[model samples]
Target chain A: MRIAVQAESFDLGAEANAFAAGVAGAGAVVTFTGVVRDLPEGGLQAMEIEHYPGMTQKAITAIAEEATQRWGLCDLLVIHRYGRLAPGEAIMMVATAAAHRAAAFEAAEFLMDYLKSRAPFWKKEITTAGGDWVAAKDADEAALDRW
Target chain B: MMQVLYFAWVRERIGVPREAVETEAATVADLVADLIAREDRYAAAFADLSALRVALDQELAEFDAPLAGVREVAFFPPMTGG
Candidate 1:
């Protein structure tokens, strides 16, 4: 498993290629990327992501460990960016590999579900009006109940 | 001395990212009460417990969790990561 919490942008194609090439004897690989979305009015300027340094890594690692254990994944990669980002920029990505597509897809979704709420990062949306912290959605917390 | 940290609006409201707190509080709630009694900023930051979350020693924890042997404590709003 590889986990990265960085401020720099990543190349999606490059990352996916690397992950797929690194895995041995995996029949399937699934990748998911999260990108920043512009507000409907389109005045969104930037998104400032804040995170607890030590705890962010710890939390993500714990989540990844649980996913790998639960799904018996062949390999996993998670990269989440922190700091200012313009709308439409890639925010993060997760890739999972397994002998079968079902496990790969399921583990990838599980990782995303946990990362949405459990990770220690917070996002503040900056727009022409001002900046506002993005509120946690009730649906996000509810998403965990299915697993 | 316990290392207490704050994040997001909590840090903004508390006016600091972190501080070393000297306290005898037995639980996370007790420590919060001590902080709330310190000044208006803390009081305002901790006004509503339901909007907040806590981490003890770098792990997510409950407000009522005991602080025994804990070296670090963090208070912040619910995470909105992805």
Candidate 2:
């Protein structure tokens, strides 16, 4: 498994090919990309993300391990962005390679659900009124409950 | 000896982010009470335990739990994490 947390955008095809290279038996690979949106009504201000240096990696690694356990995936990659990100920027990516697409897909979704709820990152939103630290959305917690 | 840390609003109320203290108390609640008795700021900071969350050794944990071999305790609002 490979995990990367960077402020740079990644090439999906490049990552997909790289992940599939060693697959002597696996015939399927899946990739998921999460991009920052530029929706007009999105009401996004400047985004400030904060994280604990060592704990962030520890948490995400655990999340990835969970996905592999549940889905029996061959390999995985988790790439997340930090620092100030504007709308339309690439926020993160999770890619899974497995013998079958079903395992790959399930592992990918599981990783996201766990990350949305458990990772230790806080977002500060700057609106026209002022800046406010974003609270844990009920929807995020709800997302994890489905699993 | 242990170091207690408060973040965000908790820090704002307590006026300091961290403090080191020795305690005869065996649990997190007792430690909180010790801080609360020190100042009105501590009282306000810990006014509602229901509104707060604690992390022992940087992992989310409960306050009613015993504090054995724990070097750090951090308090913050509900994890608004992603």
Candidate 3:
């Protein structure tokens, strides 16, 4: 498993290829990328991401470990960005490899679900009006129940 | 001395990111009470516990959790990570 919490942007294609190539016996690989979207009014200037340094890594590692143990993943890669990012920028990506497509897809979804609520990162949206912290959604928390 | 940290609006409201807090508080709730009594900013920040979350020694924890050996405590709003 490889986990990176960085401020710099990453190439999605390169990352996906690297993850797939490293897992020799894996038959399936799934990659999911999250991108920033403009607000309804379309005035979003930037999204500032704040995270707890030590805790952020620890939380994500734990979540990835659980995914590996439950799904018998051959490999997994998680890369999350921090700091300010404009709309349309990629925020993060998760790639999972397994012997079958089912495990790869399911583990990828599980990682995304846990990362949404459990990771120690907060986002503040800056727009023409002002900056506002993005509130946590009940649906995001509820999504965990499926796992 | 415990390392008390705040994030997001909690840090903004309290006007500090982290501080060294010397306290005799037994539980996380007691530590919060002490901070609330220190200044209005702290009181305002901690006014609604339901809107807040706490971590003890970098792990998610409840407000009533004991702080006997905890060296670090953090307060922040619900995480919106993805």
For all predicted structures, in order, the TM-scores are: 0.98, 0.81, 0.99
TM-score of 2: 0.81
Residue-level lDDT of model 1, residues A64-121, one tens digit each, is 9999999999999999999999989999999999999999999999999999999999
- Estimate the overall C-alpha local distance difference test score of candidate 1: 0.96
Please list all clashing residue pairs in model 2, or write none if there are none.
none
Residue A8 shift from truth in candidate 2, angstroms: 4.8
Candidate 2 residues lying further than 4 Å off, grouped into runs, are: A7-13, A22-24, A38-43, B6-25, B39-48, B80-82
TM-score-superior candidate, 1 or 2:
1
Task: Put down candidate 3 lDDT per residue, B1-82, tens digits, no spaces.
Answer: 9999999999999999999999999999999999999999999999999999999989999999999999999999999988
In angstroms, the error of model 3 at B56 is 0.8
What DockQ results for candidate 3? 0.91
Residue A13 C-alpha lDDT in model 1: 99
lDDT of each: 0.96, 0.76, 0.96
Candidate 1 deviant stretches above 4 angstroms: none
Kindly report the interface RMSD of candidate 1, rounded to 1 decimal: 0.5
- What tens digits encode model 2's per-residue C-alpha lDDT throughout B20-52? 988777889998998888779889989999878
